[model samples]
Structure formats: structure tokens, C-alpha cells
Target: MTNKPDVSVLCFEGHKVRVLQLSGDPWFIAKDVCQALEIVNHRMALKALDHDEKGVNLTYTPGGQQLMRIVSESGFYKLIARSRKASTPNTFAHRFSNWVFREVIPSIRKHGAYGVPWALLHDFTRRSADSVERGSQAGKALVIRKIEKHQLAHEEKHLLDCFQPRLALGGESDAE
Candidate 1:
């Protein structure tokens, strides 16, 4: 696909990996995945992945348009298989893979469909982000006034807020 991929930067244990799900599961930035897996040389790791399993994607970011090397879900598994912690349970690699497979992929497949009108979807996305940022303040005015909901304490609200940092990295439960 020549169209620009919708890239999302996901932080895993402080390492940020970019993902794009256009039709199937999603492709992850090879370099980022390799870094997350603690592989010293991404080029060496990428050389082992099959042709169809790897691809190049063009993504638009605030910095500018850039070409990124991406790996398919299968290629990602290859990288994980090559990881030192692949056979170990509850390792960082395993947890990161689990986070992507269990949490990220499912969510992407559910909401990343292209049926919605582009303009409306774009507006909604922008507004939703703005809402989250503004509502995260002391009073949570949106929830209290607009949604007419219960008042949530700081700790209770922070654990599951839009800007939640814990669950985004290490807190997500791994089924394995």
C-alpha cells in the first residue's frame, strides 16, 4: 500500500516501538522491536526474517515524513524467538510480546477499521485526546459536569486515566 501508514508509538518498558495496523494485525518498527528484545544489532536480526515478513513503511510524524522498516506479526515472532528470554517465562521480551498481542493487537483490530468517515473520525480522535488532557486536571470537570458521574480520587483516577503510564508499560496482565 502506497498510502501512509497510521503509526502509533507504544512504550514497552521504556522502549518505544511504533506500530501500524492497516489491514491485518500490525507491523512494528523493526529497530524498536529489536531494542525492546535487547538485541544489539537490529540489522543482523532483520536479516533472519523472511521477505514477506518484513516491509518498509512511510509514516508522517511531527518531525517529518520518514521511512521506517517494519516487521509483520510473524516477523515479530521471529525476533522474539531469537531473543535470549524467548524460552523463559515472565521475562521482559515475553511481557512485551504479550502486551502487544493481547492488548495492542486486539484493540487495533476492534477500532482500526476504515468504515467511518475520515473527517468525522479525525475530528473525534482529536477532540477525544483534547478532552482527556483537559479532564485529567484536579476537578475532572468533564466527568463531574458533562458525564454527571461519580467523583474519582486522584489515585483511583490515575490508574486508569487516559495518560496512565503504568499499565502502558509493565502493568498489563500476561495471560501466560
Candidate 2:
């Protein structure tokens, strides 16, 4: 059976970014994009298009002639959704931790921190709490060291909280 479309409505900045599927082509709507960036009018949205490394194409809004750039499906683009909390227990304390760290963190950093729900931070850090609480001094030091080395100072605290780190210790994994 075809799985139901995964959808999420995230309020970024002042906009409700609805991550939805339309015609099997996933799209985040234009109004939502503008809102996420806190651009009140079309001019600001157009200005932001120059920064789109993805060369995202735009579609006109009827009557307004304003365009919304869409990040089309491709190698780098992804669509994700939020689901209900799991009922059955799992070892992990978080759901989709990497995505939250990778995608949400940067966005939150770029935008002001006021609107995002604190629960997002909670969910992201939930899994790592045990590691933080129980790990040896060295282990905890490792977390701090990695944060200091890689992430920006502003991102350090959030990064440490949400860190799931699929990458292995010492920077190389055996599987690779």
C-alpha cells in the first residue's frame, strides 16, 4: 500500500511552513517561505532569491504577479514531517534527532529564537541526555571538544543538546 503523505506545519519566523506533498512532488508553499523569513511583502522575497544556491524556480501568485521560489526535489533537497509520539518504547529518547539538528538548528540560528517551541529542543536533546549524564569526564569532554571545534559559538549549546552524531569517534568510521 502507498504510504500516506508525510506532512508537517512548522511555524518559522511568523509563517506556517507547511511541508506537504502535492502531485508526488513535495513543495513548501511560497507564502510560507516568505513568512519564515519574516518578509512582509513580495519585494523582500524577491531579494532573497539571489541567495538561493539551489537555483530554485519561481511561480507567480495569481493577481499579484509576485513569485515564490520553490526548492524542487533533487539530490540535496528533502521533505520531512512530524508524527505523533511513539507508544512502544525504544532505546532512543528522541525521534529523528539528526534531522532536527541538521535542518532545524541552522534555521533557528538564522531566525530569531522567539517563535520556535521549546519542545523541539527537548525532543532533540532527549536521546543524548543519558550520554551527557553518564559518560565519563572524557566522554563529556569529547562532546565539548567537538562542539568547540565544529559548531559556531551560538550553535554550541543547541548542538550539544541535540547531538546524535552518526559519525564515529576519532572522525572515521569502520564502515566507511
Top lDDT: which candidate number?
Answer: 1
How high is the CA lDDT of each candidate model?
Answer: 0.71, 0.42
Candidate achieving the largest TM-score:
1
Report the lDDT tens digits of candidate 2 across residue range 55-172.
3333323233334444433311222221112112331212323334466657647862323232454354565775667677778798999887776765876765566453344255
User: lDDT of candidate 2 vs native?
Assistant: 0.42
Over the stretch 1-176, how does candidate 1's per-residue lDDT look in tens digits?
Answer: 45655555676666677677657456877888887777888888898889999988786544566787889989988898778765467878778877767777677589753223333444666899888787686457654664444444554686677556655655565532
Q: Count the backbone clashes (under 3 Å) in each candidate.
A: 0, 0
Clashing pairs in 2: none
